[model samples]
Target: MRWSALLNPGFLVAFVVLTVSAIGMSAAIRAYGLHLQKLEIHAPGNRQLSALPRETPSWKQIGTDQIMDEDTVKTLGTENYVSRVYIQKNPPAGQEPIALEFHAAYYTGGIDTVPHVPERCMVGGGWLQTKGAQTLALEDVDTSTWIVDAAASGGARGEVYSVRTLPAPYSDAPGTRVRLPFGVAPDKPIHMRISAFGDPKTGKTLYSGYFFIANGGTAASAEQVRTLAFNLTSDYAYYLKVQFSSAGVSSAQELAELSSSLLGELIAEIMRCVPDWTLVESGEYPPDNPRRRTGASN
Candidate 1:
């Protein structure tokens, strides 16, 4: 073809039309494929953790009206989020009571929607993070089995035992190894931190542990959250951020121990009520599935 002929208006229009049509067709195909796969792009209801027993032999729920203020809730994305606060009951006479705060958010977009990392939030509030975010290796126990066994036996409900101890300073030390529970191990969750606002002498100190759960599993890092959200074979896209904090903790080691114990129990409680990923993936509720009974309790 001659160069002048190729530059004709009609020829250029035809070329542009073909290019646009090809791109449009490609996009349409992708969209249709996603639809066929039945990807879950929104928060799923009836998946929130049930109201933990109001009064257990070991701990009693302290009635609290609010977990986060309206502004904080709005900042965390109010589309799908739940928060609860509880206190440890009947501790040794002199020990300060331990307080637990749990917050979970199902972000459809991605991990970026989750907000208020302790490092940032503490600093923003004029509190200094004495220890930066670090991965504390937690014991990998099959929590599903534990829940079933506990429920069946009517033993101490949600009692979890750890074979290993969490180290001090909350850092991934040389001998540290992360235990994989249920063959699902994500990035290491940041260990509870100790933060002080001003002069260490007079400032109040708080110990806190925070982590995220995605697709019925817990992850400690943003990268892990992305991994679960973007899994190709699974359409389960949800993130749950759980945080527990307390004051009057003596040392980081003590706080780490307390956090590990509380986290294990809390995860078990959450998994008991969270929707089963198998049913969610299939997009069908089988009458025989145990998750049907456990998922929508409250």
Candidate 2:
């Protein structure tokens, strides 16, 4: 604490050198961190909206994936999206066919977001809200397949093969199933919002259900989108906008129960559309695996 000690030339020079060195080290570390980001670059694949799977186990894609209008795409803020529908190829017993629609968008590295939901769009377009926002339970639908993409093995460019990997749904005894609605997986729960509206014009129940799987988890509601998409701990983020509708679905539970098959097969394909979080966290950016899904080993 002495004034003479503070004025000591040797101590003063050492203190100054240490302070400057710390500041320079900090800047260099920041630059190196930025450089590390550049190293984690993913080579693009068939992630384009058009590349969405055309068929699943029980459903056939109605047609090609639709392209959104320019204004709608601009409003959503990203073009990495797919707007498509699939029709049940073989409805059970006497049940009518089910048609499910899907729209998914992926965005990364930004905090800015815009609010867009089915309710808002429907009401503005003269639709009435028949049912309030509800958490529809998505039961487990076990669907798996083997994907042999020629691109992955550096063989022919367009030779992709498929093989059945796992047993079909309902293969297990009724005693083994969960009592509650399990979204994507048993260990990994996901959020799905199903809202019913009165299509007073068509007199048919308008069912729209959606959920989000971003980074490494899922969000059921819109409020979680911003937080999940732009967290401080990670540099990559993505969200899914899944909407399914059917005139024959009389109730929310029925819609959810029946959707198990279609969504079961479709969810894995959706994962391919987003960046792989496992690799992102480890700072490794390899080409995407077309066959990868939540529980698949290969």
Candidate 3:
């Protein structure tokens, strides 16, 4: 018998609600199925299919040359979704800061565009200054967001590494390491000291430890990627260092706003570090920084 028939018009309404409740329960169970199964030492293999598309690429490779160099330091913010807070210093020509729209992987648009290149963490607004001058306030925006790279570490036998190698504008350079100076070891949890500066218009600075799994190109195992994300989430906290031009001038509202904004950005950045778990084209896509184009035209 059809389950909806048990109740007349009135009963039918109740039956619909019951059916919805059942569906919700089922969804909840499925979401945490892995967690539950592990506790009971039962392997829930093939119990449910993964939501990710099987056809998704293995890794996203940017030619390490597509990122704009002039906008070297960008704070990607994610409050409701991904946002960009780019800081520029004398951008050449094509390197002028531009804000492209952010689209999430789960979001549906006319066309299925891959999610924006998510950053590991938001390194709050940076200090823009000349060699001999103090940092100045150029541009500031609302708190922004960045994506966490959770899948880089192909689980199990794979390794995850975070680096801060540098030469200034490192994001746009191919095969360049600015500083391996700061990063967590493979399988270690991610942590960082986040700092910020604010004023009437000047925004804050947000920084965090780098955390990415090394999914050995085409040769990585699934376990390797999973382990990388697992280790990263273990240590998650925002150490925000507040930078202010003049102390006590700004009221609590201003300071609170800045603080809250910084925190939100931090969370979004961490999310980016999480592996997309989807395959993507691999290659170094460098940013088109005009400064790079001007050959010796400082």
Candidate 4:
């Protein structure tokens, strides 16, 4: 009688429903496990990551500056980040002054992990974003231009010890660095035109441009970053936010162009110092890589 009651159609149906529901819930929890482990997310040490070179032939690095105070860093809620403010001077007369602020942070929380972006930070600092955000891609760059003469002069005989020894550009000439016109593509990087209204009587029009790179993917909009943030396949997450401002630009268009060129050059130099996403993702440092040690360009 008890066996018959257990095997009744209604009881069997109810048991099946409960079993399926339990299995579905367990799968859902496993799929969204990253969300549960967000609080435990921690980035590797800043020293473990790659760094920018202090000097380049076209641009001389004056010195490094801090992007934020301790208070600000704490407010951002990540200690595994690096901030570098570089004052660089272009040669010929060293007159073209360029200032770059590069801040890279690792966060494993939801898409809203990064609280500071150009839109929020600029407005909070009393600057107004006049132009809508746009995308810019730094592609097909003539990488030969990045290779310094010193490395090229050594020829292919000896092992080059400098990180400044850039990968050969796609050209017929193998050893020589080629000079080409810097071109801008319309994609990827997020750029915004910003202005500040000081005392109305003496208002100042300052220009600002910024972008964010998540893992290795570039996002031109905050929405894009948020959408890309939920990657359960990867164990860790990282983002790089680069911001710079130039004063006395004639127009937002001019500022955008200049910002693109400067940032492209800076990024090229930076790549030499930082490890690739593959290495970072695996949390494994390459052995005998000069860039990993001393953070020097060479």
Best by lDDT: 2
Angstrom error of the Cα, residue 171, model 2: value is 22
Give candidate 2's whole-model lDDT: 0.59
Better structure of 1 and 3 per TM-score: 1
Show model 4 residue runs off by greater than 4 Å: 1-22, 28-50, 62-64, 80-88, 91-112, 137-142, 145-202, 272-275, 279-298
- Please write out the lDDT profile of model 1 over residues 1-298, one tens digit for every residue: 5899998999999999999999998798665433223234432345444343333333445665355678876776654555565666666799877765545555654434544566666677677766655555544322332322221122221222211222332212222322222223223333333332332655777766566656645566766766765554443355656665666565555556565655544443444334544345434433433334445311
Question: Model 3, range 47-150, lDDT digits (tens) per residue?
Answer: 11111111111111112212333333222221222222212223347753221111221111112112222121221233422112122221121222122234
Error of 4 at 296 (Å): 35
**Model 1 global lDDT (CA atoms, 0 to 1):** 0.49
TM-score of each: 0.61, 0.66, 0.18, 0.58
Pick the TM-score winner: 2
lDDT of each residue in 147-177, candidate 4, tens digit only: 3223323332222112223333421223332
Model 1 clash number:
1
Ranking of models by TM-score: 2, 1, 4, 3
> What's the residue-level lDDT of 34 in candidate 3?
26
Candidate 1 segments exceeding 4 Å error? 1-50, 67-69, 79-84, 90-96, 109-112, 140-202, 232-236, 285-298
Best of the two (1, 3) by lDDT: 1
Give the CA lDDT, 0 to 100, for residue 124 in model 3.
28
Better of 2 and 3 by lDDT: 2
lDDT (CA) for every model shown? Answer: 0.49, 0.59, 0.25, 0.47
Question: Over the stretch 1-298, how does candidate 2's per-residue lDDT look in tens digits?
Answer: 6889978999999999999999998798665432222222221463654555576557778877887799988987877777887888888889778777766666654455544678888788788889998886676554334344332322222222322322244222111211111123343334468888887787767777777765555677777766665554444445556666665677877767666677676655555556554455444444332213222221
